[model samples]
Target: MAYPRKPLFAPNGAVATSQPLAAAAGLAVLRRGGNAVDAALATAVALTVLQPPSNDIGGDLFAIVWDGERLHGLTAAGRSPAALTREMVLAATGRRAAEPVAALGGAQARGPAMPARGWLPVTVPGAPAGWHDLHDRFGSLPFADLFTDAIGYAEHGHPVSTGTAIGWARAVAGHAGLVGAEFAEFERVFTVGGRAPRPGERWRNPDAARTLRRIAETGADDFYRGRIAEALDAHAARTGGLISGDDLARHTSTWVDPVSARYRGHEVWELPPPGQGIAALLALNILDGWDPAGADPVERLHRQVEAVKLGFADAHAHVADPERAPVPTAALLDPAYAAARRALLTERAGDPVAGDPERGGTVYLCTADAGGMMVSLIQSTYLAFGSHVVLPGHGFALQNRGTGFRLDPDHPNVVGPAKRPFHTIIPGFLTRDGAPVGPFGVMGGHMQPQGHVQLLAGMLDAGLDPQAALDAPRWYWHAGRTLLVEPELAARPGLVAGLRARGHEVAVAAEPSVFGYGQALWRGAAGWVGGSESRIDGAAVGY
Candidate 1:
């Protein structure tokens, strides 16, 4: 079946998003002589104020940029404070590391009472550092100009899109009691009639507006080391949290080369080791040996499923911080290794394996300007509202990315002072010969790799347009056991049973199962073509 909306194919500049307003804001920036980096920065900042439930300024950011010829990955993820040790947390609570505390959704949960609050979900905030770093490197306009649209939205308010409203309603109802007073204030600004504001409803965030003004005036230092940092530190101390002013001041974003592997003559690039982008690359590498071009429908689907499993298995075992794990990057991407991995895929399915959740709630944006600069950017609060701890006076929630760290001392991703955790959120890009093909991202946690496979298949093998590739039916291996197929896919009567006959535990999800929010832009003979996911309330706009 075809998607409801037509595919967007632009020949010049284009922007796609989960919200039209956000896309328009970014497009406006591009039109005003800002490059892709500036447009992406503007969209990210606006999302923080407008889509509070899914993302925020207090979250982490990751990106892959097409710097003309090669791709570069930036790990804007933050780490625990230097003073934060597993031993300290254990000592404070007098509990063993592996012992299960209250379930995240259960009564007596130790973290913040509300899911949107900053206290329950605080981690090092990374977006500010990331924005500054990207601007310093590739921006054309003044740094302060990037905040104009975001600041205006935060102060004067923007209409809450349908997607934002749904997410906010869920977060407010699920986490109201868990959050502290600051978040309560946030709720007041966002909620209408004691619930999330519906689509087209104007929503303002005055506190965030003020915070943006401060950052524009004083630079990111106001956030990393100045008054905002002081407020964040004081709030943490009063709440018995571990973050300190020093952690805020010391936080920095790292720049590295993106990892890429060839598939069907096109090169797919993604963020390296710590992020799961490599997992997606690994999966594509394994599938490279399979003749997806001529395979029957069932045969093609089986190959893709097997590739996902093998890639995820390797991810669970090897993907972690390169600094700590000595990740065998060369070995894993080796053609021989891919051939060996592909050998494990039979004509049938098998038992599922559970994958870790890196960052769950996040937003992805891609932009390109007339200057030929392009950016694939992602930002997240880790989980909804992050640590759910709203900093008292800053109006920013913190990230809960610390959850990705393991308590096991032997694990490569073990929690330690100032160590980056295994990251799940990653941005992707593609190239042919030496030119940029598209900037893309898949947002759902473990579903990201699987989403990449499908998107690649649609674009490269099936010849579908970018929006069609995104709106196509998708499947996910949730918790590694159940195959939660999208309703559209599940409509095929014998498909689920066929997988079950092959030893797969198949289950039908009530909704669309795993929804992947993605956007893409490809260079056509004339110019650039872009498509935003129709499953979301986003739009693709260009000149």
Candidate 2:
């Protein structure tokens, strides 16, 4: 029988990434005898150039790698600048630290809540640190070798992908009106002729090329403790921003033990706290007892969304910097806790409050080499252009990841000095009976875990192929029963009716608010089989 969507198969190697150019970059590295780690870095770096709207060198990085032996996790997310304190933020924005973050222009009526659009929302960038850390450990290629594709694309040019074009234009439209110089840097880098780039239009960033070269030659030191740091400091000082050379110099990516949970016979692995990976595991854990395959299509999807709602609520309460997080990682992922949380899901859609749990885009790439090495990596510039503050001379955009923090001083993720805020982007991996299943991930904002759960259930429970599982109609449970379901699901005969009967406000739309793009690659009996996102301009390549 043929599958709903065909999977790309390869024996020597395979790559699945959001951008075709970046996937080619990885395939090139693999052809040169580079391992998965090298190819992954190359792909990641290339993306900072090709998919400039979604990610950049300025964002943080996270990855889960299987080096043919043990799974290794890397946390490259940066900390809040030491100079940035609750008092300082309150003084700058004139809002109490304890107040809930106001909407952009809500009557709670203050400046945009919690630095939603500027330097104050940017943490020290962690991408360079992460690249260096990955290379220093598992990479086979020289550091500079990874930059060739990225530099070429940035200096010469690259054609915008469909997904990237949509995102780029949306970002430009969102920030069209800003009075200050800090915001001008963002407009300068992303907009051409005061507009988002048309799809297939050629774009170049020589400034980013120069910056990448400096990072390449200096071994990433320039980004943290050297000239790169100086430029960042000068920008921050001039703009009255809190970042400094010390913040950049003090940053370090940490090596961490990955967390996992068993769903049926398969083990799903994700990065630990400070990331929302646990949320995916939490949802899966709750659904482990039920046989999703036995349920009707609507029933299966409803259970997944319900479980995710519970997981997100707990995450809101418990997940944060491990240092300040109220809920311990061990307690959060305990099967017993997941079981209890699972009980909250019922026949109707109702917002479930967290008892007291603990808790958590941009691009997701999975590359596998012949040697059995697989890397699941994700990086992103939070909130479009990220802080909407680009350095004048440097080519990279600063991530507004600091916007992930809470303004409520009592919250676990409350704004504080050097604290890593709650993060949304997560990388996922799967395995069965001690053997490698392969690397897989879905990229979007809060939609990541929801996508992961749906894809896994489609394959593991519903017996669908990789491509079929990914291409299957998806539902985005934004909050409670408010759902944005793909039009495909609407046409599933009675899928939408069943869901609406269960109290879900299902809005059937083709785009339904960035439902997320996914990529999956696993060790098949034949070789490596993989697939890319259908919603974007990309493909799965094998060789």
Candidate 3:
């Protein structure tokens, strides 16, 4: 199993992404003397152009980068607008107290707890500012150079990949036309003739190109405090939304230290609070107590599922913006907490109670340069097309990330001025003995951290190579007892029966794509090995 099934090996540099164009764009940058950071930035921007349904200029961004000596984590998630509040949403929706996520299906004689796709949940976008912060820190190429390929694709056109086309169609059906008249712009721009583009269809966005060109020329400041911000403010004002010019001007991405846990001999790292990355660390810490190699596949899945629940319970209670509600990243990831939670796991799924912690559509890419620099970056528009309130004339949508904030004022992640919500997307990294091992990540709404735990276990415990680790069938646990198993995995004779016997209410995923799409790069003696999830239109490329 350790043998790579479809590993792509490279020597000087390597880049992997969920889209071939994005991967190639990054690799081309590296080939042209760009470092890993430059390549990662290129790929991230290209992803926004190539996969609009999953990631776009509208979303948040997070990254874990290893620069030979140290690992740096970035929090690029946007905060609640100064003018926005939970009460504002309640008022706009005509409710005393807005509904919660649990009452998502049209509350009993009540409007939905929160607006899933509208300006009510629009937060200030941070990806543009995030790109500038990253480039300012580690880029070797001109900031504008990083977006060249992405701009070309946006202005001209590119053939849609099978997966992206499928996802785009779903977004059209799910996010567009469902809101109100304001979302009409989304239907106009995202769809072709009022329908999602079919696979192989050529799509272009000159508006997005113009926006990128502006950012390229003036840096991301144009997005945060300049023209784009003005447009956002005007749109918000016209649409009765919350974002203000002040909100955009005050936005800045935070640079933080990476939080990590040791699994076996290697260290697994993730971005700290406000993101669900801790879920991966917590699960790994809990799994560290047992001998994974000795456990059967069912046992491994069961253990990870249980540990994730505990992590979520704590994260929901504790994880929030460091400025608004500082999370004790060190204390939360302490060995003692994980060990105590580990002790609660038994033979079957347990209704694990939280010790009272705390905490999308997404694109994850990784790049490794010959100079020993590696970056694991992720970005997302939250729910497909994000808010569905496309900014007319600007060619980009705004993120519904604010929907993540709890309606409860007592909650740590409750909506507040300039507070980052409980973010779902996280980029992951690995190292051994203080040396960089590589960069890795999975992207799929809440399935991100879940995928991280599964992928890390597959490689660390089962001795699977990067590709085999990614290729392994996936299982996701949710809402307590329900376990969604991939059909490929459900077909495994005893797997379903075994899970059901252990108290899991098993259901095979009708569309396995939601499990997640991942990209990974492993650095070792030979050079570099990269893996892209088999379920996407992705590739691992290098020069």
Listed in order, each prediction's TM-score against the native is: 0.92, 0.94, 0.94
lDDT of 3 by residue, 115-135 (tens): 677887788888998999999
Report the C-alpha lDDT of model 1 over 423-452, residue by residue, as the tens digit.
778888999876788898778677788888
Candidate 3 — which residues are off by over 4 angstroms?
Answer: 1-5, 97-113, 179-181, 353-359
Report the lDDT of model 3 for residue 151: 96
Task: Judge candidate 1 against the unseen true structure and give its global Cα lDDT, from 0 to 1.
Answer: 0.75
| Per-candidate local distance difference test | 0.75, 0.83, 0.83
For model 2, the superposed segments whose C-alpha errors exceed 4 Å read 1-5, 97-113, 353-361
Q: Which candidate do you rate higher for lDDT, 1 or 2? A: 2
Instruction: Please provide, for model 2 over 406-503, each residue's C-alpha lDDT reduced to its tens digit, 9 standing for 90 to 100.
Output: 66565677788998988888999998987899898988878888889988987888777777778887878765468888877788889888988999
Candidate 3, after superposition: displacement of residue 19 in Å? 0.3
Q: What shift in Å separates residue 69 of candidate 3 from its native position after superposition?
A: 1.0
Off-target runs (Cα >4 Å) in candidate 1 are 1-3, 89-121, 177-194, 356-359, 510-513
